[model samples]
Target: MVRKFYPEEFKADAVELYSSTPGATIKKIAADLGVHEGTLSAWLRAAGVTTVPTAAGRADGGGAGVPETPAEELERLRVENKRLRADKSLLETEREILRKAAKYFAGETTW
Candidate 1:
C-alpha cells in the first residue's frame, strides 16, 4: 500500500526547503519527504520555480514570464542603477555637510 501527499502542502514544503537551504539535492529532499525525486522536481516546476544554467541577460533563454530581449532589461537596469547611484552620492554629500556643521559648532577644525 502507498500513501498520498497533499499537493499544496508538498509544494509549499518544497519551496520552503529550497529557499532555506540552497543547492539542496533533490533526491535527498525527496527521500526525506517520502516522495520520488522526479515528483518533487515536477512540483517545483509547477510552482513556477526553475533553475537556469545562466544568469539573466547573459543567456538568450530565460525562465517563464520573462521578456525576450536582454537589451531591454539591460537598459532598464542601467536607468535604475544610475538613479540609485545619484541618490547615494547626494546622501553622502549631505552627511558630510552635517558632519562639518557639527564639528564647527563643537570648536573643531574651522576649514
Candidate 2:
C-alpha cells in the first residue's frame, strides 16, 4: 500500500479538532478527515492530548483526564438522550414495517 503524507498544518488541525470537540471520538474524526484512527491518535499524542478509554475498550480522544462540570455533564447526557430517542424511533419504525410484512406473508400462505 502507498503511504500518504499530510501537511504539518493539517496534523495540527486534526489534533486541535480532537482536543476541542466534546463527545468526539478519534475514530469518528479520523473517518471524517479521511485518515486512519491510529494516525489521528499519534497526532493527538504528539500534541500532548490525553485520550479516554471508551466502553468498547478502545481509546477515544474525548479528553478523559479532565473532569466535566455539572452543566457539561448534563448537556452531554441530554445529547445522548436525544440520540437514543431518535434511535428508538427508527427501530420502532423498522419493527412496524417488519410486522406488516409478516402479516401480509402469513395471509398469502398456500396451506
Candidate 3:
C-alpha cells in the first residue's frame, strides 16, 4: 500500500531539509525529503533559489570588494552620457529650426 502525505507536511519537510542541509545537492535533498528530485528542483526554482550557492547576489558579474562601486558608477555615467548627448543633439536641432522660423517671419528673404 502507498501512503499519502499532506500538502503542509510535504512543505514543512521540504523546508526543513533545505535549511538543515544548506549545501546539499538537489538529489540528496529530494532523497532526504522523500520527494522526487525534479519536484525539489521545481520547489527551489519557484522559491527563487539557485543550485549555485553564491550565484544569488555575487552573480552580478562583480565578484566582490569595493571595486564594484566604481564599476557601477562608471556604468551609470555611461548611460547618463548617452542620454545627455541625445538631448543636446535634439536641442540643437530645435534651436536651429526656431532661428530659421524667426528669421523668416522677421522680413528675411531666402529667394
How many clashing residue pairs appear in each of the predictions shown?
Answer: 0, 0, 0
| Candidate 1 wrong stretches, greater than 4 Å | 1-3, 52-111
Better of 2 and 3 by lDDT: 2
Error of 1 at 59 (Å): 19
What is the per-residue lDDT of model 1 for residues 1-111, given as tens digits with 9 covering 90 to 100?
676666787679876785454334566567778777667777777777654222332221234455436776565566557757878999999999999999888896558
Query: How many clashing pairs does model 3 include?
Result: 0
Error of 2 at 57 (Å): 14
Off by over 4 Å in 2: 4-24, 28-35, 38-63
1 or 2, greater by TM-score: 2
Candidate 1 at 22: error in angstroms?
2.2
Q: Give, for candidate 3, the lowest lDDT window spanning 10 residues.
A: 53-62
Q: After superposition, how far is residue 47 of candidate 2 from its true place, in Å?
A: 17
Colliding pairs, model 2 = none
Local lDDT at 77 for model 3: 58
Ranking by lDDT: 2, 1, 3
At residue 51, what lDDT does model 1 achieve? 42
Give the C-alpha lDDT of model 3: 0.60
For residues 13-90, write the lDDT of model 2, one tens digit per residue. 998887776556888889999999989988888989887444443555343355666775676677667767878999
Reference-based TM-score of each model: 0.39, 0.55, 0.37
